[model samples]
Target: MKRSSDRTIKWLILLTPTVTIGLWEYTRHAFLLPYLSMELGNFLAPFIVLAVTLTLVLGLFRRLEQSQRALRRQQAATASLEERESLARELHDGIAQSLFLLAVKLDQLDRTAQDEAVKELSGQLRETVREVHDDVRQAIANLQQPPSPASDAWVVPLRELLGDTAGVLEAKAEFRWTIPESRLTGKEKVELHACLREALINVRKHARASRVYVVGESEEGGGFRCSVEDDGVGFDGDPMKAKERFGLKMIRDRAAKIGWTFSAERRGELTVVELRKAGADA
Candidate 1:
């Protein structure tokens, strides 16, 4: 929708003046020459075209932008609903079932376990209940979050994703964005969005941090960079070599494919994932 609107505006900008000029000249020479002078017509034609552009073409451009914005919001809202349903299904089918099994086994153990095994079984039951309790709390937090509004600015989705991740992790999420609208290409935005989402997923599953900070900026010399920093216990080992960390690998591969530099490392007390795109000339 956005692309079509943009293309229509571009065509209007390019063709409107040329078509108007051709018709003006044709009418002046073929029909109006006896009535209107060449120099006077020439002087009036530019103002006439400008007036038409300011009124007709610009009006259409604004209208198209408005329509596109409306369509995008509707799409976002639909996707949000679908995602919420999927999350609810996951909680019910996956976590809820596991919790039910744990509760059942704990009940049987409590009823029949001998004194010697009681300590171990009790510890196991406690651990299972704690895990289930945490999972339920997180799920409830996620389901209770209000949806954010959609808009042309990329920050809406960015903020929404961060908020959701924060709710799931029960972490404090902070981010600062300074990348100007014109600084990023559409491809850059897509890559950044996916990478950041993966990075936040890693934080949720692995970081166990109380605070997560995501920073994005348009650097000097046209460069763009973003960093996801978490005050979590740093990776147990090299994040790239961790057995279950396909997310880190995927982020690296994606950044490489997109010609951006990616890094995950412990910086002071924070585990940081940084992705950087070089200046255009570089």
Candidate 2:
């Protein structure tokens, strides 16, 4: 439609002067030769035609420039989609495959273990590896999905994640969140979610807790913290022993990378894992 309209407008622009000139010549010869001379009409007619043509040419140039800009924007969007897909493929083929292989190895260990403790440990390792494999695959799936124009509220995805964990871990879970919307940035939300995921996984695998309570609350000033507490067979001997655990180490490293504080400890009969960051705006 736009192209057709442009063609019609261009033809009208070009034909208007031709039609006017023909009418002027015919009228001058037939009715107004005494008043209007041929030389004056001919000379003035060229100027009028030149001015109209220049105006139309400038308008056409502006439209063409806009069309080019639209084309470039479309090309950029296509390139971005291709890049995202390529990254997803790399993750699936690389990290995802490696995780699957590790899970297989753990399964083999579980089968070949001589003692009950080793067999149980191997079984737990296999479960953890499978969970990590699911997480990586989910990340790749998210990448494959089209990017949203705006970020979502933090609680939305966080709630869904916790709900899934509860079902998978077969534990009763309660989530109470009161942190403000402005509390977490996009990157901060990712780190916080990762930490929470690891904490919940720990509850499922190690804590043996039947009930889990998760609370997110604002701190003094503008900082915020989230705690995952469980009435489990709390941490063993030393909190520092968590350094040897993969899930704890992963969450702690994620928090450290984001300059947030992460800690896991025993409080009475409940095991508590907390992740927090102080806001710069405070």
Whole-model lDDT values for every prediction: 0.80, 0.77
Q: For every model shown, what is its TM-score relative to the native structure?
A: 0.46, 0.43
Instruction: Write down the TM-score for model 2.
Output: 0.43
Badly placed stretches (over 4 Å) of model 1 are 1-152, 280-282
Superposition error at 213 for model 1 (Å): 1.0
> What does the lDDT read for residue 20 in candidate 1?
85
Worst 10 residues of 1 by lDDT: 143-152
lDDT of 2 by residue, 257-278 (tens): 8888988888787888988887
Ten residues in sequence with the least summed lDDT for candidate 2: 146-155
Give one digit per residue, the lDDT tens place, for model 1 in 216-265.
87777679889889998888878788886799899999999988999998
lDDT, candidate 2, at 115: 99
